[model samples]
Target chain A: MRIGELSRRTGVPVPTIKYYLREGLVPHGERTSPNQARYDEAHVHRVRLVRALTEVGGLSIAAARDVLALMHEPGRGRLGSIGKVHFAVQAARQPHTDEPSESSVARTNDLIEQRGWHVRPTNPARAALAGVLDYFTRLGQPDVLGLLDDYADAAEKLAVAEIDTLGGRDVDHMAEHVVMMTVLGGALLNALRGLAQESAASAKMT
Target chain B: MRIGELSRRTGVPVPTIKYYLREGLVPHGERTSPNQARYDEAHVHRVRLVRALTEVGGLSIAAARDVLALMHEPGRGRLGSIGKVHFAVQAARQPHTDEPSESSVARTNDLIEQRGWHVRPTNPARAALAGVLDYFTRLGQPDVLGLLDDYADAAEKLAVAEIDTLGGRDVDHMAEHVVMMTVLGGALLNALRGLAQESAASAKMT
Candidate 1:
């Protein structure tokens, strides 16, 4: 297969494919001649993953490269790759606020202790949660704090399901699955929340 | 009661406050002189809301302006403001993928019907869900679809809580609450999910 066929198959344009090649997002095809290159099944798979990351996952080229590097690393297990991918994904979501408050940190720590969650305070996700709480505190919306337990319950259930699914997959397969779920899972959850809000509001009306 | 005081109180920079004022994200203060403007407590509140929308929500200036417009409109209730703010916020989250597959659309419609959700098929959130599912199908990861019911369950619970809280607030307060929850809620949920994942993984080790 050639670049043209790859483009047609993946729905990614030829120039975008070239751009990914230049950015090292996709591996270069074999140079068959001065003007021709040949791709293989592996290239097809790689290109598709690239599209998923960039287009669906909304990851930048740099982040996508980091994720792909982790995925392609030889002998990397599912857990290791998931941790790395999780870190990379967090680093990629640009943070807009400055330092969080001490109260926010205390609240997050308390939540973790109460729930017995295994994540360390140093985890970026913990900081992310603290930031939201801090902003709420600043804005005087303490009522929003009441929803934490419910959110945690839902989140815990989701994590168990995700981890169980990860247990059955091979390392190679696990890499893509981890990235896709971690990246797009937020969007899916959010969209469903929006739909659910409508339903809730409708129920109230009746 | 000056711009400097508003900045000092909100932790937003003086230049950023001016920028927001110039961009119409925050309402202009009363002109006291050719170069001096006197702000009030309301100014402080508006500036904080603007910061939340732009910084935490990652909404563009234009979208923030639109959201603020809806918020400031006279006699607009919480329900009306939520619909408008939801529209503005959705417009701000730039979609990376193109049109979704027919199957994706059909599947989303089926989910809404099966769940008896009150949302219409044309809701942007439904399209967003279909787009995620379509990406999953394209990536040959139909297994991700299996988590839809669980995700919906979580989403519905959160929505019920959110709407319940909204019922107790006045229109003025509801405007800010709706935006904050809708924007920062995703971050909070994602962070909790990350913590829960770590907990699940740790349990496996033990």
Candidate 2:
């Protein structure tokens, strides 16, 4: 298929496809002639993945590129690759200057210890969780902090279920699955939470 | 305090504060003279809320303004106000031209019915969940659909806890709390899930 067909199939514009190609988001198509190139099923799949990452997952182009590169890198353990992809997705959003507060960090560490979660000390999510805890305190809604354990409990269960689904998958499949589930799965859970909140509020508030 | 002091107190720059004022994301200060306006503690709080909504929640300026306006609207029941805020935030991100597929909508309805939820049919989250269901199918990951119930289960428990915390709060406080929790709480949960996934993957992957 030509670039035009790739654009049509993926619903992405030709110029955007060219831009993605140039940015190394999608690999170059085979040069069929001086002015023509041919894409394949892999290109179509890659384009769709890129769109999902950038459009639905809200990852920046650079972050998406890094994720793709990590997916293709050889010799890293599956856990290491998953960790790197998760860190890459999050690191793009955090500014280096905005450090988490000490109290928030202590609170996050307390939650981790209480849960007995085996997360690395340097997991970006440790800082991300602390940042949110700081925001809750700054917003004067420390009462909400009481529910942190509940959230963590649910997160543990969900994560267990998520990993169980990855059983027996190869490294490449596992990496892609983790990235999609980490990003798109977040969106799915968020949307489900919104619906559940509506139902709960209606039943309780009225 | 003037706009400069408001900026200093919130750590938002003067020009960005001015822009928020112009965008109606923050209430205007009282004009003390032709060229001078005085802000107050409320202004500081509003600026911080605005920054949190846009910066942390990833809401657009217009969406943030709509959320703030809804917070101030009179006579809306607490549940109604929360529903409106959630709808406004999600609606801002969804383009009107895109509609969820019928199968996805049916799946969402099935999940709600199975959960015995009392959500209104018009809840934006209904469509949002359907859209994500569509994405999972489109991505050729229908196996993930098996986890929908687990996600919904967690969402339900979290929502119950969230609404329980709102007990006895007045409508105004409830509205703000719902908005913050809906947005920032989602972030918190996402971060926690990331951490949990890291631990789970480590234990199960190797």
Q: Give the DockQ of candidate 1.
A: 0.67
DockQ of each model against the real complex? Answer: 0.67, 0.60
**TM-score for each predicted model, relative to the true structure:** 0.92, 0.93
The complex in candidate 2 yields a DockQ of 0.60
Query: A175 in model 1: Cα distance from truth in Å?
Result: 2.6
Residue B45, candidate 2: C-alpha displacement in angstroms: 1.1
- Model number 2 iRMSD: 2.2
TM-score, chain A only, candidate 2, equals 0.93
For residues A6-95, could you state the per-residue lDDT of candidate 1 as single tens digits?
988878899999999999998888999998899988887788788777765566798889878987787667465567766666655634
Candidate 2 per-residue lDDT, tens place, A1-206, comes to 99999998877889999999999999999999998999999998898888778876777798889888887788545466667877777665432224779998998898888888888877888888888887787777866788888899899999999989888677667778877788778878888888898888889856
> After superposing candidate 1, which stretches have Cα over 4 Å from the reference?
none
Docking class of 1: medium
lDDT of 1 at B103: 88
In model 2, the Cα lDDT at residue A175 comes to 75
